[model samples]
Target: MSGGVDSAVAAARAVDAGHEVVGVHLALSRMPGTLRTGSRGCCTIEDSTDAQRAANIIGIPYYVWDFSERFKLDVVDDFIAEYSAGRTPNPCMRCNEKIKFAALLEKAIDLGFDAVCTGHYATIVTDDQGNRELHRASAWAKDQSYVLGVLTAEQLAHSMFPLGETPSKALVRAEAAERGFSVASKPDSHDICFIPDGDTKGWLGERVGIADGAIIDREGNTVGAHEGAHAYTVGQRRGLNLGVPAPDGRPRFVLEVRPKTNEVVVGPKEALAIAEIAGSRYTWAGLPQQHPEESFDCEVQIRAHADPVPAVARIQPTENGDEFVVTPEIALNGVAPGQTAVIYVGTRVLGQFTIDRTVSAVPVGV
Candidate 1:
């Protein structure tokens, strides 16, 4: 239940619907904190206790499953590796894909459970032919389908979201209060769960280690120096610490992180516009496209809260493998490799791909 208002209310609603529901809280950390630092992190010992209390109130079974080892290998390690490769990754996306749906759902089915229900703000729709599709929740402001974009057809078939049809998070909170859930007013967790302090740079610095590197402009001129290339991300402007400023007196933003050469590239904000992105790692949510080679119209979303953009997507053959490519009508800002791009047709999630390459809208020396 995540020890949050949303999950507590979701469990209550599931019980009210006359289904046998059991609340399972995943212990994702081997060494979890005794208490949460406000709402900065989750999956701690405090969260597990709150979940058990809520389960008691709801009159259901509660269990804390230890998934720490798997979480570290799949999500945490992947995050460090992506950063080391100079790509920004969405850890929530990986957690949803590998740990929650795949690992948890697999164990659930083996234990005779029909589906793994959660409080995620997303919907699952079944057609007449029994094909299940993933869609956005009714409340766009709290929609979380972007993070769940990695679910395949099989996973969607055995998934349930109790709060999908709810109009607002305020309503969920009210329902939880009415049900006497202690977590009704609990703050929602934000940022990476494992990194409780919300200092991603400092957290990564310890694991990835720091190396002095040169920060250069687009023209290959050194402008500043950075402690580590892994500490910076595309489009970051505040911590450049550049010794040299732009000749035009304009601020420069991080345009790229070259891990191999240990160089951070800075440039004008306009150069951050990305026109194209593609990757070989991809999976369809429900049904595969009938014509894989043909370009199809769709909307692409890179971040959880980012607005969808009009785009054209198609599969292209590459020497390494087949790549899912998207070209947005309007350029995407600060897109980076290792970030996932979820494609949507109307409200339905078509599929998603790990972006491995990006083509800038503005070329160098332009």
Candidate 2:
């Protein structure tokens, strides 16, 4: 439980179902000071206390598991490394993949638990062939199946999402209030958990140090100087501070971040259009053999809230392994490397992969 209404109500429902459930809150930060002030923090003392209180109200044991070390190594370090390599990463996906399902689930199973339940707004269902699949939550706006796309079939087998069928956030809060949980009105958490202040660039700058670089236009002319190339992401439009205006009287956007040369490439917004996205580290919630096809059509969600786009997904065999490629019917904007590309067949989540590269139709500037 994340000390929120959703989890509290989820716990209540679990207990009502007559299953032995224990609340486990993960302590992800190494130095969690006082509880954060705004709605940007998670895994803090306040959250844990709220979770414990809810657990007591539900008549179940609760424990705060410290996974700070593993979290830092897996999620934090990976975030830094990806940015340093001129790629953008979704750390939440990493946490779900490495820490929550892999580490925490394994430990829970060892401790004799049949499954680990969470407050995530997603669902796990069995197909007619007895195959487990992940699906979007009934609450479409609050669906978080995109983040949990990294879960393999094995992990999906041992996961539960009680709030998946909850129609709305208000209903969950009502249930929490009905259960007499104090966090019924608690604000939902937002932004990155570790970066409670929601200043990702500032947080990254302090950790990766500064590498002063040039902000260059499409023609390779330096338009401005940047403190670091790693601070910017592809398709970014603001804070470029480019002293030079476009010759064609057009606004500039970040088309690329060249870390090796310590340069940021600026261009017209149209330059961000990408026709193909190639991803590595692919995972499927269903058996690969079940499909028995090299290519399939599916809807691809580039980010958590982004609209799903129609695409043809190809599983290409390479010497290293297999790479998943998505060819959207229309160009996508702001697709960045290291970001997760979640695949869906209707409301069911097929799987996801980490974007490694992209193919753009438009040249640097036109």
Candidate 3:
């Protein structure tokens, strides 16, 4: 349980189903705060206590597993490395892929647990052949399948989501209240868990010290100077403090962050439209495509809450290896390397790839 209403209610429902359930709260931080900053962060000491209280009410065993070291190495360090490399990464995806499902699930099975159940707003469906597939939850507004897109077929087989069929988060809250869960009205955590204050730029500036860098426009003209290229992300418009404004008096957005040269590239908003994205690192959620070299129709989701876009996906051979590539019918804006592209067929999560390259719809000097 994450000490939130969703998880508490999920635990209660699991118990009501007559299954032996144990609530495990992951201690992801070495130095967690005593109290949450009004839901700005999670995995704090307060959250653990709240989880224990919920477990007590549900009449189940509760344990706080210290995954801080692994979390730092896998999630936190990866975040830093990606940022330092001028790539935008989804830390939640990494946490779900490395820590929660892989690490936690591995330990759970060793301890004789059948599956690791959580309150994630996603579902697992079993096909005719008994092959498990990951799908979006009934609550579309609260769907979290995008973050769990990294789960492989094996992981999905030993995973459970108690709230997957729930119609709405309001219903979950009501159930929690009915069950006398103290966290029934608890606020949901937002922003990065480790950086509770939500100052991502400041947090990164501390670790990857600020370095003077040049901000250039598409024409290779130096438009501004930045304290650090790592502090900026693609599509960011504010805080540029550009020395030169666009010739047409339009606002410029960050188009790329070149860490090798310590440079940030800014350009017209229209230039952010991305036509193609590809990456070598990918995994299927359930079954692999029968014809990997053939392009298949699918919907591609770049962000958690972003609407899925019509696209064609295929695995193509490259010098590096086989790369998963997607070409959206409509150009996707502000796509960046290190972001995950979750491919979906209808409601089922087919697979996901960590984007390493993006081809702009608008060419340079266009």
lDDT of 2 by residue, 26-140 (tens): 8987688623544567788888888899999998989989998899899889999999999999988998899999999999999999988888999888979988989999999
lDDT of 3 by residue, 184-284 (tens): 88988878888866788998999999999899998889999999999999999999969998899999999999999999999999999999999999999
Model 1 C-alpha lDDT per residue in residues 1-366, reported as the tens digit of each score: 888888898889889998899999999877776224556667788888889999999999999999988999999999999999999999999999999999999999999999988999999899999999999999999999999999999999999899999999999998888888888888899878877667889989999999999999999999999999999999999988799989999999999999999999999999999999999999999998779689999999999989999999999999998999999999999998889999999999999999999999999987
Clashes of 3: 0
Off by over 4 Å in 3: 34-36
Residue pairs in clash, model 2: none
TM-score of each: 0.98, 0.96, 0.98
Q: Go through the candidates in order and give the C-alpha RMSD of each one to the true structure.
A: 1.2, 1.6, 1.1
- Model 2 residue runs over 4 Å out of place are 34-38, 289-293
65 in model 3: Cα distance from truth in Å? 0.5
Candidate 1 runs further than 4 Å off: 34-36
Error of 3 at 306 (Å): 0.3
* lDDT for each candidate structure: 0.92, 0.87, 0.92
Model 1: which residue pairs collide? none
